[model samples]
Target: MIDLFKFFGKEESKSKDIAKERLKLVLIHDRANISPKFLDMIKDDIIKVISNYMEIEEAGLDIRLSRIPQEDDTYSTALVANIPIRRVKNMGPNRG
Candidate 1:
C-alpha cells in the first residue's frame, strides 16, 4: 500500500491571489464614492461650465472625482481637473 499524502503541495498561493483581487475591488470603490456612471455625468457638467468662460478643448479635459483619506472626517471627496490652456487669437505675447 502507498501513502497518497505527499503528491501535491498545499494551497498557499491561491489564498494570496484571492486576497489581492478583493483588495483591488475595495480600493477602487473607496477612491470613487460614486459609481462610474455618475462620475461620467460630473465630468461632462464640469467641462460644459468651464467651456462657457474660456476657449476650452472639451475633449482634452480630464476631471476626476476621488476620495482622500485623512485624520479627521470633514472633507473626504476631492475633485481634480486637468485643463490645458491654449493661447487664443487675441491673447498673444504682450506687445506695445
Candidate 2:
C-alpha cells in the first residue's frame, strides 16, 4: 500500500524548497540594484577570475547579493560568491 502521508510530506518539502529559492532570487534582485544581465556578466567574470588560480565546481558556484544589517539600523548590499574549489592550479613563473 502507498503511504499517502510520506508522499505528501515529500511533496511539501519540495514545494518549500522551491518557494525558498524563489524568495532568495527575488530578494537578491531587489537588493542588488543591478540588472539581471549585469549580474550574469559579473558572475561570469568572477568565475573566470577564480578559474585562473584554481579549478572550481561551476555547478556548485553560488553568486548572489545579500542584505547585511549595519550598526546604524541600515542595510547594505553585499556580493556573496560561494565558489567550490575542485583543485588548485599550478601557475609557473610568468615570462612576460
Tens digit of per-residue lDDT, candidate 1, span 1-96: 654553333345667788987775456656655676787888888767756556776667876655566888644667778987553335346642
lDDT of 1: 0.65
Expressed as tens digits, the lDDT of each residue in 16-91 for candidate 2 is 9999988877777876668778889999999988888899999999988777889999888888889999998878
Best by TM-score: 2
Q: Report residue 42 deviation for candidate 2 (angstroms).
A: 0.5
* Whole-model lDDT per candidate: 0.65, 0.87
Q: What is the lDDT of residue 73 in candidate 1?
A: 68
TM-score of each: 0.48, 0.72
The residue pairs that clash in candidate 1, if any, are none
